[model samples]
Target: MSACNAIASPVLDPKGPIAAAQTQLLLDAVAIMMIVIVPVFIMAALFTWRYRGTNRNARYAPNLAYYWPVEILIWGVPAGIIFWLGLHLWSATHRLDPYKPIDPEVPPLRVEAVAQDWKWLFIYPEQDIAVVNELVFPAGRPLALRITSDTVMNSFMIPGLGGQIYAMAGMQTRLHLLADEPGEFWGRNVQYSGRGFADQQFRAIATTTEGEFGAWVEKVKASTQMLDATTYEQLAKPSVKVPVTYYSGVQPGLFDSIIAKWHGDGNHLHAQVTGTEQAR
Candidate 1:
């Protein structure tokens, strides 16, 4: 498919360097495997046609037990492919580690992501604003996401930006991504939690310039709505296809609080909050 039609398969339609690298790696792996697969299928068809019962003149070597050249060809080719694949996979795993920050020269924008029931909550701690079922960030800037779930396990993914990571109640996962250019992409929960799983999707907007992102934040901040413990409790309840909503004032350390609440003991919860309170 053309890049213009990338919205249909976000994984194939990468908008950032990290995602573009991943897409290339995927294509390389498929191409390498097809090298062996295509030949094997073609040889199978040729052998079937040449040795068919109707072809009485076909050579038959029933006693062929140990042919060094044939044995080498059969085993060496697969081993070579496997070795090449292993090397690429190892390199990609380390280079694309989700925890590894991107573009150290450019400080990453921190965003706290919480997966609740059938919706997504994105809190911009630095900006002191929050939005539900919508995320906005500036293009050409690195994004560092700290993700967790308040309910059952879920996967936070933006196929056009980078890979997917799991989010569990009480456990926070990190993901780093960036947008090479301005565009809108799709984000969704890949893991099935309940009846509303299919509707658990959001829009990721990447603005062209820092000024545009700042303006968007200001617009959200102008909203009179507030997101606090009480409001969060209501939002946490199971819901489907929720409309995009913005909150002007967000409670401090709200993301950490949600993760802490899942811990069994009060002391652990307190410790978790204390350790993360100063974190942006």
Candidate 2:
């Protein structure tokens, strides 16, 4: 999408009220900071001109110690600004903590996510399906995602949404998001993992209806190879800028296995190979 169009989309159709509120709050904070920053910059320039030694009219007070009131203006003002900022930030962060549930009336759809070397794997336990390198969901439905990483730490982020959540090995994190409209959005592995760090990104396709979403699942399942235990072992290997792929059937609870292995389980010997496969 054009940059102008992308900018307009988020405003015109925010994922939900919470996201819209966040965007507004961000813009407001920027404006407030600018009020102080702009004046400080202007004064800096003015001081350079007004205090020029070449101008004999300029008074130079060599014995000048800071006046108490002037010191108060310098410290108190910034402290107050910081206090205000801290209050707003603290409240907003807790209110929008990714793990917190939304209103009871609007239940969220749950999806489990895993970040591995060079790719993302999303599992819809409710739908009994999975996808790699692509995310699809019904637009307007609240989505609550439980995320983790198979090996290294990664971050789940989509700019048009809100704050990102970190996915670390053997640990689960949560993120709640929704696309207000039907279209494609991009999500990335914001943190560097290995060779593919620069291009470890994927598309999120939001559908208008549940039927459309089901059709998508069927299509993906029909078009891909069956991902069994062996294939998954190959997939988990590290690599760079790997292209996207869809798997019709992945080994049962593969993500769980990865998490277990990372946590020091001995069930899978494959997981024991550490740095050797870092390049895959």
**Tens digit of per-residue lDDT, candidate 2, span 34-66:** 868998999999999999878779887899987
Off by over 4 Å in 1: 1-9, 265-280
The residue pairs in collision within model 2 are 238-280, 239-280
Clashes in predicted model 1: 0
Give the local distance difference test score of model 1.
Answer: 0.89
Model 2, runs deviating above 4 Å: 1-19, 250-252, 266-280
lDDT of all predictions, in order shown? 0.89, 0.75
Q: How accurate is candidate 2 locally (lDDT)?
A: 0.75
TM-score of each: 0.91, 0.83
> On a 0 to 100 scale, what is the lDDT of residue 126 in model 1?
96
- For model 2, where is the 10-residue window of minimal lDDT? 271-280
Q: Candidate 1, residue 107: CA error in Å? A: 1.3
